[model samples]
Target: MSGKDKPKSAPDVPGATKAVRKLGDELAEARQLHRLLVDPLLNTVRAERLRVSVTRSLWFFLACGLGFTTAGVQAFLADGYTTADPQWWAAWLVEPAFAGILITLLRWEAEMLARRLEVTAAVVRKLKRLLLFSTLVMNVIPTVRPPDGHSFNLGNLFVHIVIPLIVFFLAEVMPVVQEMCTRAKDTATVPAAPDVDLDQQTDEPPADIVRPAVAPVVPSVKLPPTVMTQVRTTLDSVRSEGRTPNVADIAKVVALPDNLARQLLADLTPVNGHTVPNI
Candidate 1:
């Protein structure tokens, strides 16, 4: 078996060529799918969800930071063993540390808004309630007792315990009460959009002319398809004619009450064929 007997290193096998061809086909199929599929809307929704989630997480973190800052400040204020010459830097540092937490939260909140997320509205409401409760407690409790003469009695009912409880109640419970009131009003007040008079805009025109039509102010009454289609046509007519359509015309087309027609129109007009902001 000399060099000649080795016989030209066995002419590149058929199985190897077939395997390469199969691999190429699979790769082409993958690329074809990559080209044909569209995912921008799904990606957009996912991005929005992620933005809201991150905003919530940042607030939760800030809440934790607030707890730590409160504790740290309490300690600094209550430490009784003072130097003959007080440490001005350590005393000054406490104020700056609280300021840093506030500044970071402000920046993060700004970023959250830039993302077009509505998280700040809810957070602001909560913060206001907390501030109110804290102010109320500070007024009621003239002085906070210091524990061990080295730390403030943040654990006591009058300062830490009772104030936090009030804040929690205002932030959490008051919103529920407000929502219930809103929903109750909606139940009584909601009427069909077709019944709405476009000629008489609401108490005020929406801030943005092109703003999506407001959701129906009323709730609870669901319209059938025939009624909904009629409402859309009526709106198109109203917009085209530059005058509100007659109640009789709407009744003839959809057999709906005038109020119901108006409500339906209100809900569907500006938002026709478009998604509006959730808030």
Candidate 2:
């Protein structure tokens, strides 16, 4: 293609990166708001599904890298090695590249507040398993793995096994990282804004402070036995799924009018520390 015919790339603006980041932050905030106001429990499940996807993606990428590395090295060293230098492959593969990344995870975890369902490092704190796994991986390679090479060399053990084990220990001992983590709960515990009474603050005391007539409290209307029975059944079904019943959802599930469904929900109370929806 001629130089003039080629499409020109857009020039990067000074604050373009910052602007994009701001947009992303706003979007994330909106998502959190939706989760809180719309479907907290359902959104929790969705976030978990997303994390599983991310973890699987990472594993797939790592596997692909392994395959590519194997093929590329084989291709580069065209002729099969009658006497291959095991040390060269050991140097290339034995170093734990991800050890530092794991440390960052540890640091982040250390900064977090403890949760009710707290994580324990009982299993991971053991230095033995990390050493065992890294050593085993090193052994399985053709170029003589680190821990148990063709010969039992002290230098090989220190470089291949010791270092990797140290890295793993740091990942666990510094701060144990959970396989799954979560942000702190944003439960609707904040008190509603206090009622403002501006007239009470006036300098002149009123002769007769006329309090507005209070509206009569509404009585709970009794429903038909059949409808009430259906509401009870539907709520039980919802609770079984570990979800608190909402007006719209209860209406759909029980085939009741939205207003009636809301009325039924009002009669119920929050139990077991679960937040009832503000229907």
- Model 2 reaches what TM-score against the true structure? 0.25
lDDT of 1 by residue, 209-247 (tens): 444476534543454443446555665677688875555
Worst 10 residues of 2 by lDDT: 184-193
Per-candidate Cα lDDT values, in order, are: 0.47, 0.45
Candidate 1: where is the Cα deviation over 4 Å?
1-16, 36-38, 76-279
lDDT of 1: 0.47
Query: On residues 1-279, what C-alpha lDDT tens digit does candidate 2 reach at each position?
Result: 997787654334455576786886787777666545544455446655654565455444534433333332332333233336664454444323333333334444555422313345565334335543544354334234322334655654444444434434434443322223232111112112233344357776467755446843333434434334555677778888999788865554233344545655766545685634322
RMSD of 2: 19.5
